[model samples]
Target chain A: GELARAQPVSTPEVEAFLDTLKWDKNGLVVAIAQNVDTGAILMQGFANRDAISATIASRRATFFSRSRSQLWTKGETSHNFIHVQDISIDCDRDSIVYLGQPDGPTCHTGAETCYYTSVPMDEPKLLASTLYALEELIARRKTEEIAPGAKPSWTRRLQQDPKLLCSKIREEASELCQTVEASEGMERTVSEMADLLYHSMVLLSVQNVKLEEVTTELRKRFGQSGIEEKSKRPPKPTAG
Target chain B: GELARAQPVSTPEVEAFLDTLKWDKNGLVVAIAQNVDTGAILMQGFANRDAISATIASRRATFFSRSRSQLWTKGETSHNFIHVQDISIDCDRDSIVYLGQPDGPTCHTGAETCYYTSVPMDEPKLLASTLYALEELIARRKTEEIAPGAKPSWTRRLQQDPKLLCSKIREEASELCQTVEASEGMERTVSEMADLLYHSMVLLSVQNVKLEEVTTELRKRFGQSGIEEKSKRPPKPTAG
Candidate 1:
């Protein structure tokens, strides 16, 4: 008990907690940090004994950087630190999860998390974040070097030429309008929407913006009067 | 249409469009800018005839600033501009919604939109963003001027003391663990959760981070295998 008082967790508390996790052969446990309140899984990393010790000792989420081959404390560079809240192991005990409270975006590219991108993202619930996924991919493409014999991606090519990107957005938007004005139950609208969505993702990617923020805007207005919401806004600073 | 060009819309078309709006006494209409592809509303502003004209002329979102008493283009100073896609008047004609393609976050606080804050937010969808709202509120409290004869808010005081903030978070987190282990569907669990969530938000806000990003991490993992997802991660740079 002496080890548990007056700090986030004492050295013994850290040791006791680490003792519970069933580490892999490499003396590392897969650490998946989750949001404690919402029960939302946040991000995942690897933690060796030292890393786990560092995490509980400091009460910040620390992990073994596989690439660096040493203990790594998240947000060491970006200051987007993850605060360890509660640690739990899976039923099988082969993996561990640290309910981490993150201070800012966790992903390296400044999006929300490291797991934003998913392949074949084809589920109904997953649809909501699809645009965001595309936005992240386009962002990755911006700095990612192409593999030999791989066709150059349009997002990168457009990033090189801003004019084409802007024009493409406008063009796709016009097509969406036409699709909207089409006959009742027009099937073409979905395809047109996909076009617009792709182009808009490209546009947002170029600007280095993520799509989740937009959904947050929508969620804020869920029940409130639009006029009232508008009124509450801090006035935009006027021009000179 | 003098503004007509090889684009999604033309100049005369723009003027004809604005003609449908029933502007208020000051010839202004409330403009709600939305994400064209996602349909998530982005931001809101007031638009006079001149502002609308400028928006069309420049294809940028220009608003009549109430404070400056002049036309202001979004991102004029911050370079976080909103690119106008399509403008449509609401059924009432007193308001308009602009399908905007934002180049960056539209809010002055570097948030995605101006309408992020909500109160007593209780709903299915609102639940996800509620943590974010709390985060934003705590952040605002950090910068808000003290009112005359008002009790100092805990969040405010906690912001002033980093050590106290860290301790408070740890305390609440421990309580949450106890509650979780209680009887099935224990009522105190929710309250403990609220406490932990609040403390976490304060901790994040002090670190200049918001909670929406955390939820995005959850939303992205909606329909995937955590194991497979974990494996796909680009190997963290090793051998530094």
Candidate 2:
């Protein structure tokens, strides 16, 4: 007679799970603090590998305390715990990204991240990048490296004749003036104007004018009444 | 009478499409600034709305100023214009979200947002929402508000037998201990611990223990050395 056999279980049962489990020293583990808002890594600290362990076990956020030199639960004091949704390490595995919903602001000063000032990107990075691209294209054109294609690259065409870039700048400026006259949806106007300005920047770069130079000149004109600045400028003598 | 075949006719094409648009007097419009990372609305201000119009026309982010009152093109000086990817206005059409990549930090103070304080969230707001949800659930349990064909809620059961909540708390704490003993991925431990802490808070709320009272008591223990604090506590006296 064939006897009915019980199906063999694949996953570990709860009792067996307990036997396989090990112990954490304290409810603490090391945690690296990061800015949730700006995507900037702020500071690093430890949670009781056990506290952190507990946090993960509990599905709440916890961290180790370096100041007390012990495992202390987050939100225990401030009632604010960094909820952990997911964590992943980098290629080298030295750091981690603790991604989750932050209970409140992170920085002790209450700012988003620590590094606020960014002088490195003084000019718009896009404008700078575009300008660099134009310059490189111009240099390539001079060396006969400009490729012929169905869709003519603006830069390649401009490289063939520098005057074309200048004319485009003038055209863009005049177009901007016309757009200003019919003022609705400043959004579109601003967008088109940016294109004009970026193209203008390319022309300027071709002529060796840096963004800083323009900014310096604009700064000199700042804080002065527009009328006052205009009055101080040398006149065109009314063009006869 | 038949119309004569007309020669190819061309309507006027402006040099720049934006130049055809017009703006209002004072050349200013409202630019609503918000924290790019955290979706918090910060203070709003006017841009010469025209200078910004010009900046926008130039494909750069610009703002109108009311004080010096000229259009302040963002990144004009700092070279950090909020790069324009897309722009949308609110229902009333007074404010806007300049949804683009901010080249660098937006705040003048070098912090992320203008509001940098994480003061204790006012209690009234807390009570009306989160606290209210907890209270309503507890009250339902107390009333034994079981619906047709519904699994009994832990809260409802706890309300029926108040001592059971305490027992569960003790049980979870012991389970947490076992998880911690196994030094391993502490994440699971934290998740379980959060449940314990949250449940503990519910019990405290049910028992009329104010959170502030607990916080005040904890504050007293803050600067004391862990060793000193732990040593002073008497160990459980053994029963004869």
Candidate 3:
């Protein structure tokens, strides 16, 4: 929990006006972009009056192009459009966050998100995007009709036949289990689990099944009883 | 436009980890919820293992309920949930920004956002929501075939007949022009113009037309040659 201990800046009327006032000359504010569906930090930029106005007016994120001294709407050239659901300023009024949906990979590079540098913790956008992509891939699999041992789009293949995909999901899950059983810390355990879950999502997507469906069914069978839900799923087949 | 003069904290990998080591008492991080849609400071809360994991797993914003000391997923109860898209961390490595789509009002009080009070600026989400609601009402008029004069709802009546809505828009524009013609300073003129524009948006939304559509059309018709775009719009229908 956070406490906004800092007193509200005095001079309420002026502060209010300042809050509403658009940037003059060089005034700017930090703007961070995050995925609304997956909970990932995509990128960060700066906003001036022109950029902020454009962003709000378009319901898409925009930023002042410091390099060109002009407005730069993200994905303007790439078409990796981000649709803004909302925007908020921080307590100090120095920064903002744009929460919205992403149309494609946020980073110019092929990565799912912008921040690639390992900053100890994965930047939120990357994680969200990766998960979102996996979800998309999984959903796609459900609609795809393919044959066993046939090379379709990886996702299509996963969906055309469940056996192989299940095998992978089980393999990844076992790996995840190994990490936890070995007493690996949160970082390793989380990383392994993420891989397992992602594969599982991919498997589900290929089948055209929704995670929500599984959740609803689970809830129905268990009725808020996690222990009971776990007890009901068929046991995993032994390693081949 | 924003420049954070705060120097990037650089440290040896080991040193950085050691220096910023938060004891794993609960094994969680602090999450701050700001209204990305409205620029409001909603609330502050924490994420424990279950909270963070559930948020990531579900792709919905979840925070640890400090009072209950358990994982609390926002929107779980209200259905006005924040579907997380991206996340980020401050340089200090202590706090995070969760960006996502808010299902409805973020605050419990039915405000457009969580950080409603004390925020002075005209938040985008508030304006957007108002505009969105107005647009829906307008669309309903066209779709449901309501009668303008006989309709009970003011917005519905205006939308049922385009001519009436157009007349209101013209009246507001005329009033705005009169104010501008009489006003002296920049601030007063700008203020009057904003009101005019806002009313104009309401009128436009009522027609099942978005301001973006007009702007986009203007850009398309007059984007390459600005002069031509201006020449085509019928000179504001000659205020009469």
Query: What would the per-residue lDDT of candidate 2 be over residues B140-177, giving only the tens digit for each residue?
Result: 45556568977565554543443555455444433333
When sorted by TM-score, best at the front, the candidate numbers are: 3, 1, 2
lDDT of 3 by residue, A115-215 (tens): 44332433323222233434543464456666787545554554455555555554544444444345455444444434444445554444334443442
* TM-score per candidate, chains pooled: 0.29, 0.25, 0.33
Question: Could you tell me which residue pairs clash in candidate 1?
Answer: A67-B237, A67-B238, A67-B239, A68-B238, B3-B11, B4-B11
Model 3 ranges with Cα > 4 A deviation: A1-25, A120-205, A208-240, B1-240
Native-to-model Cα distance after best TM-score fit, residue A171 in candidate 2, in Å: 82
For candidate 2, give the docking quality class from DockQ. Answer: incorrect
- State each candidate's chain A TM-score: 0.46, 0.36, 0.48
Interface RMSD, in order shown: 22.8, 34.1, 26.8
Where model 2 places Cα greater than 4 Å from the true spot, the runs are A1-240, B1-152, B223-230, B237-240
* Model 1: per-residue Cα lDDT over B8-101, one tens digit each: 2336655776686677667887655654333334555678877777766666777787667877777777776676645544333555545456
Which residue ranges in model 1 land beyond 4 Å of their true spot? A1-240, B1-40, B43-103, B106-132, B145-151, B184-186, B216-228, B231-240
DockQ of each candidate, alpha-carbon based: 0.01, 0.01, 0.02
Better of 2 and 3 by DockQ: 3
Worst 10 residues of 1 chain A by lDDT: A119-128
TM-score of 3: 0.33
lDDT of 3 at A135: 53
> How much is A81 displaced in model 3, in angstroms?
2.4
Winner of 2 and 3 under TM-score: 3
